[model samples]
Target: MRIGFIGAGRMGAPMVRRLVGAGHEVRALGRSGDARRRVTELGADPVSFTAAVGTEAAAVVVCVFTDDQVRAVCLDTPLLASMPGGSVLIVHTTGSPRTAEDLATQAATRDIRVVDAPVSGGPPDIDAGTLTLFVGGTEDAVTRARPVLECYGGPVLPVGPVGSGQRVKLVNNALFAAQLGLITEAVRLATRLGIDEATLLSALQHASGASRAAATVAAKGSVTAFNASVGEFIRKDVAAVRALAAELGATMGTLDSAISAQFPDTERKS
Candidate 1:
């Protein structure tokens, strides 16, 4: 398969490597010399955005940051215009559900298929081909993109129509953010009771209250340490969730309290 890829950063680079290793002809959009070198090192043929999508391809995978970047690459550029009729555009970015729906509508005019295929896990998961994809598209679109998605995804779930994937991903991230708050507070409460941080985390793992978020906090040695590493990213996702909730006139339910406690400033800003 001839594949066009965008965003060769931490997550994107490994996915490109997996595609290249899977015997696909992977051409990546490289805007800078360093970006080109990085993708090349991963066995991709790095090219400009125009060249990447200009040629006929079986699929194009986008793994950029932010909703704006996804729109810029797919809508503001020549991507949708240059892609062939039957090719599928798989978006791996976690962003607005509306972005996917809007792009799908636009791309449909050109006979191109669009799949909102936001992924979970990190670079290591991509390298190991264990990343999970929350896919949203027509049956035909999902079927067409499945084989290529399987190159790096373990479970490619077709949740529903065009924007459903992003909806699910947002909810997933929001829940994770809530879990971070719960786990962090629990650690604090344990400390107040004279229990050691390490000991409390270890016991929790064997208890019914054990969770992935708790494990993550434990691994980092403290909530402060974990937040220092990923708080900004989590905050970004949380903000997206809050925006979507407001747009839909929906509430966050219990997630509201968790987000408020963990990210007071962000909650207030939203």
Candidate 2:
């Protein structure tokens, strides 16, 4: 399948490489010259601009950050207007379900098929080509997308109709936030009880209570909560989940409690 990719940040860059390696015809867009070079190095054609990528590929996959960023790229890129009818657009960002649904509606009006197919697994996971993608769209659309999705992911499970992917992603992120909270407390307790952090982690990994978040915190330690790229990312993701929960008129109990512990003040200090 012919694929187009937008955003070549940490997550986006590796994903494009995987698709290219999978032997798909890939066109990619990056906001920097270095990113463009990286895409080309991966054996995929690098488009000069976001607009160029949108117009050229049969399917466009967005892997940017945030809901607003995704919206700006799609609406302002002008590639949507240039893409031919019957093209497919897939959003891979972890954002609000409403944003995905809105984009799908807009794409549909232009004779484009759109779906929310947000993904999990970190950059390392992407490189391994074992990422899990949760899809939100019609059953047919999900089935049609599986082959292309398989190029970059595993288990392309259907979450629901348009935007359901984002909804599910939100829940996933929220759970991560909560899990981090649990592990943090567990470590604090363990340390207080004369157990070392490494020892605590080794035991947890073998125990039934072990989870991905727990393992991450164990590997990263308390310091990663304040530093590291993923620390910032998780803070934003937790916030996004909280804001979405507020909009949905639901309480993000575990997630909210988790966010309070992790990033009480995440203003990105100047």
TM-score leader? 1
Kindly report which residue stretches of model 1 are placed more than 4 angstroms away from their true locations once superposed.
268-270
Question: Residue 57's C-alpha lDDT in candidate 2?
Answer: 68
Give the top-scoring candidate (lDDT): 1
TM of each candidate vs. truth: 0.96, 0.91
lDDT at position 145, candidate 1: 95
Global lDDT for candidate 2?
A: 0.77
Across residues 1-270, which tens digit of lDDT does each residue of candidate 2 receive? 788888767888888887877888888886678877888887888878777786756788888888899889888668688666777888888888888778878888887887898888878888887888889987766765676788768777888898888888878877877677667677778889999877888788888988777777666655355346477777777767777777777886555666556666643211
Q: What is the overall TM-score of model 1 with all chains considered together?
A: 0.96
Write candidate 1's Cα lDDT for 47-96 as tens digits.
Answer: 96654554798899898888999998888888888899998999999989
| Candidate 1 deviation (Cα RMSD) | 1.4
lDDT of each: 0.88, 0.77
